[model samples]
Target chain A: MRKAYSSLESLRGLCGLRICLAGSRPFKREVNSVKSRAKRLGLNSLTFPRRMYLFAAPALALFLVFWVFPLIQMFFYSFTNFNGINFNYDFVGLKNFVNIFKDGTLGNSIRNTLVYTIVMVGASNLLGLAIALALNSNIRLKTLFRTCCYIPALFSAIVVGFIWSYVYMPRSGLLVSLITLVGGDASKLNILGNHKVALYGIALVEVWKGFGSTMIIYLAGLQTLDENLLEAARIDGCNEWQLMRLVKLPLISATITINVILSAIGGLKAFDYAFIMTSGGPGKATNTLMFNVYRIAFNEQLMGKASALSVISFFCIIIVTVLMLYVMNKREVEL
Target chain B: MRKFRLKPQSVLLHAFLLCFCVLIIYPLLIVLSSSLRPPGNMDSPLLLFNQFSFASYIRAFEKMQYPKALLNSILTSGASVLVIVLFSSMAAYPVSRIKSKTSRFLYYFFIAGLIVPSQMVVVPVAQMIGRLSIPNNRFTPMIMFITCSLPFSTFLYAGFMKSVPVEIEESAYIDGAGLWTRFAWFVLPLLKPATVSVAITQGMWIWNDYFYPMIFVTRRDQFSIPVVMLQFLGDRENPAQWNILFAACVLCALPLIAVFAVMQKQFVTGIAAGAVKG
Candidate 1:
């Protein structure tokens, strides 16, 4: 993405030029309209330049209303004991937040989400890196392989979840049938029924659906590798495994960090597979933070707690993301 | 000399990859097979092309209100693509072209939306939409689709625009072309690839997206395909209606996959470049 348009660039000489025509007008201006008239005329007059804000008004309106406003409402409502449908609710004063801590499912949900994140992020990136390495080799029909690898990702997460539910559908499911075919006597297997395995089972599908994109990203990153470096390492008597560990791995550390961070964030907020595969399970085994937020808000009608959860989730996501980015940035070698 | 296929490494790689491909495509094959079968709990894991039929597809289409749902999805996603492309492209102009102190600040301000973890905002957005008395409306999600999509779209457009030299617009200015004219005639044509990338990326996103639609769209008729499919998958009128449900799943996925097939490279390239979503 950092590489600028190579062959596909259509624009000739329009970007970096001084957009202000010579001797036309200064780009910035200090307007001196009457103060009250300026107030009546609006804040736009005092702020952004006409053309720039004209270009940005629609998007900013949307950004303010849909994204920014709701977030404020979410925070304020989190402090209240508000039911979802009505405007009548007293200020609960951390009651909802306290209840969240006391709520057993909250702890369970957080743990399950962490477990899901760890397994999904770990398994998918490792598997994705492996497949990327395999496809990165000199091979026939590489495009076909790439497409096939990515087809699962093309399906909606809901659809993928539904399809995998069929795959894990106890005795008659494809997975069970496959196991039975190998004389494993797994016909009565109920992967989604057992709380112990259900989270991981759902995580499996998430990994399955997600790894293709990870592979594609890795593949693209691999293409950017300096081949002479690899050849030099080989000439230094590095074997295939040594070359991978010493040359390929460290060189692709940037890609590794990127893929890990993305998949980790994805895993932390994973809802579709958990919700669809087991309906948050035979128990609340797969109840992720997002899914629990949905359940509380819509199902249980505890909008206050849900709003609190959403606020917590927002901060949790931001803090973790920033920390990961900071740590990764610190660790990234200049090479 | 031994044939190239005789290499142990090549054999191992091919075997691993072929098996991997089958695993990946197997559930898809099951969907295809089940969509062809009569309403039944399919027990077999083996794929049977000989049993293929479209009877389930025909019934599944009606049961899921496939046509209406499809139209809703198309209208919403198509509108999202157009809105994002237009606003973001227009917005990209002043941000990229005009070198000023505020432009950098504006760029970061807009791009900050990308970090807000959109799913977190769903709670209040749903309630706010309800308060606005437009709950269950398509246009509400349209606002969301645009808002959530803008940061990346604007980023991409601005990035692409940076490669475009400012001389062309200046030349157009010399010829007495107004801003909108330069934008419409000269600038938009120059933004062809960026526009398509945004359209393809955001369009697919809005189409495949189920969460927002599931929350906002309450009526059966208004439900997008994914939302409707989820509703029905839970209710299944008959226990043996797995085939029809699978058929619905297939139908829901087919159009996007078709879109993917035609614009495979763009879809992949857009995703790899943008990383729009967390």
Candidate 2:
């Protein structure tokens, strides 16, 4: 332990030396040259303009106070037992985290969150790719169709939830009525009520609402592909399926990865829909990590535990992001 | 007859596309149809083709007090977009203009803001706002909107500003134009396309945002449209009249949908450009 401490002290000393070097005469000479060049070019000195920094001050200050500080405090609080009020608490050292491990609701929330992420991300990207491909064809009013499809994505999550709620209402919902018209038993189809189907129902709504944005992204990726490759494949007697599978998919691999990561992060942080639609539902069926955090923090006033959950969720998101980057980089290197 | 073989596959593709389009359009059509349905006839199974009425629209307008909420949303979101665009562009100018290590460090720090989820900071921000004695008002939420939007807008503006040939600014400098003047006349005008795209993207987000306003603004009169609609649905006293709620939703969504439809080409092009540039 003493040796480790000495090593850390040496590292700090090295950092201090570097800082001294940065502030030494050689740096001043470099600054003088840069300033002279700036004068010749009718520009400000190399040192950032005081007024410009002042103008940028509000943004930087707000981010630090509101974003950075809160995140740091949240990390600290996660290790403690500070409830919502009277921010005085002891650091119990992983007790809260240990509690989470044994907590069934949290386990369920994690499961639900993962399930939602996989299904929503998978379905949205698949549907989006399909839509992009279909729209890529020689169709009339293509622009109109694309715009129409993307309209739902512009609606706020709250509004989308409300609209879907009305659509899923058991009594007079459009969906229920349609089911009845087809001679299917509509009474048993309370999508938001059934435990088994509620999570999937929410995932379906999310996919429906989000697919258009992903489709547009894929469409952009498609535009970047070389038409010559497709022609060559066709000339080589490749069928449409084989041509797309071999040529188009590989070309747009990066975009698919991006879409998947975006969708996954979106799923993990999802709150508005679950809050508005099911409020974490009949027996925590649709209770995701974010929803549980909100409930625990706001409703139950368990701030420390909630922060711990959020930190866990944040780590989960990072892991997924790293995995995505790894996969994308591997693909790039292989190509 | 020589090329008839491709016709079958093409027809099959079209059939699949058409079915998917219908599926996508179904819920929206439902909302439109339901909003138009007379209030008393909502329970009927055959309500799809029922004669339409504006009764629910009228009632929703009255109950939700939508006009005031719409005004609030427009004012807040518009002001946010204006402030974010103006300030972010001003800040991005120097960052992009200077090629120093410090400036690059600051630029990366600004972009890092995008990855941190805003929801994670809600607790402390709320506490800070409360502690600072800033009353729960529309302006508070508007400020929050601008603050959250700054990083992305700045990143976008900086990226675009780099592509802008420095020659334009050099000529302005040679003309003895001051820094502010150069930015105002030369840089700002050239940034119009980026500005419009930023406005649309961030404006749509702020206008549709429910969480910030729901948590910050307490007064019903100060509530934005999305929060108001959410309250109407979640309120227990008058549990959201479904038809009326759908009518209000349709109204709330119409402006954005109209803007998107009209600017569909620019919207898609801008997003594609932004993604590629990023």
Candidate 3:
């Protein structure tokens, strides 16, 4: 009985080795077949592509459910007079769009948005470029200055607004105190009060909060520039200003394009500071298209009109983004 | 060879930068000073020298129920960041590894979310929340926050993941590791820097977001710090006391500011890297 059991165990061991060898051969064969197939079909061939799609299914599913569906719903809701409380409102075709076009508030808001975008984007990038240039030079305390400047960008817009609100307070705010200290009548100089200046005030705060980001982008771009070109210009007796204008600016064009595009989008969607500081107030001097949309939807319950405005804003963003891409692509340097 | 002279341009550049720095720091200094000042003396013109006190802090804490609000904000932000990081990384990993046209399309589809402003979807999202009978509470806001943050986090992770060499993954696959194990053991650790970036950015955003909590969570218990601060701002039938508001604002912003200051280098590096790569 013991001999028979030993022989059976040996036989089982041999069978296992044989099976392993056979399986290894088929696996190798299968791998070779795949390699040959892949070689025949290019990198993104059908069989390999099928495998990739299978892997990517989860991300695709999430995009469809969360992003695409909601966007479509937003579009559909814009067409209908849905007040959000009841989802069954009638489809008021073109009425919502017409209302926005005719509404004086909407027109004012659009104008305000454009003005805000121009001032904020323009000032922020220019200031950012200046700061970047300074840091790139042999400036002392570069790290400290960068930290201090960038700190404001980290704060929430609400917090920044609240802080600025106090600073701009007509009575005891810092700005008022500074003016008073200089023998000026501080009480009449409410920075956020003058209609003509309110938008600019808001834009200034926005630029203050945003310039750090643009500076960082510019710094990164500056780092990528070829030092040899700058040295060559220096040897040719081109001064610092000329080198900056002729060499640095053209080299960092991509970063400038990106900063402009991003800041433009941020400007059009400017809501938080304006909303919290003025609530688009002082005669709606600081009301942006987005701020108006928020007021219309939540405060006034003009859901359809608000959605229509959002669609307008959406299309505006798309157009601007496309324009930016076109302009940036056209100017892209091959280096 | 002339001795180098200080150019007017250099002096002016320094002056402008100094002015810019002052403009940036003044508001923050004011808020900090006001938060520390006694409530009764808040209307004084000289905030810097007014007898500094912490009475406003105590009052703001009591009035805003700030302890509760702080706890709520921390918990919600924590959970939201975890959800965003985990789900987004998981979803992004597959997309990054995959090389099909559909996968590329899916990648663009996710990025498209970045362009759609959160305000655009507020009405529909709010309606959906109501219709689904999702409890109008912190959890609900958390879910929405996760959804909104998913796009950016996924985009960051996918971009980072593209740089990871596939050989490590292939070796694991050959060693009998399944897809889940390969990701958990190999891919996740490799994705630490990107994960940290996504976490910090999304964490700060979710913690600081006002609109989501305002629109979704109706109850007081569910109010995040920003919402609570807004409520405090609005509770102004009486003459609004600036000291207490400033005190609350300080408390609300301090944690994030502290974290950001400590990690500013990493934060800046991560964002710059992500932007360049993307």
lDDT of 1 by residue, A62-134 (tens): 8888888998988999999888778889999898988988977668877888899899989999999999999
lDDT of 3 by residue, A1-335 (tens): 99999999999999999998889988999998996787567655421233434444554554555556667788888898888677679999999999888867667887898899999988999989989998887665678778778888777778788777766777667788888888888788788888988999999889988898788878878888888989999999998889999888888887888788778878888889778899888988988888888888889887888889988888877787788779887886667
Scored by Cα lDDT, where does model 2 land? 0.80
Clashing pairs in 2: none
Q: In candidate 3, how many clashes are counted? A: 0
Give the candidates in order of TM-score, highest first: 3, 2, 1
> Which 10-residue window of candidate 1 chain B scores lowest in summed lDDT?
B269-278
**Residue pairs in collision within model 3:** none
Reference contacts recovered by each candidate, as fractions? Answer: 0.53, 0.40, 0.38
- Predict model 3's lDDT versus the native: 0.79
Cα lDDT for residue A52, candidate 2: 54
**TM-scores of chain B alone in all candidate structures, in the order given:** 0.88, 0.91, 0.89
TM-score of 2: 0.86
Report the lDDT tens digits of candidate 2 across residue range B37-140.
76644565344646678998998888778789889989998888898888888878878887667679889888777655667667877877877888989878
**C-alpha positional error of residue B262 in candidate 1 after TM-score superposition, expressed in Å:** 2.0
Question: What ranges in model 3 sit over 4 Å off?
Answer: A1-63, B1-16, B47-50, B235-240
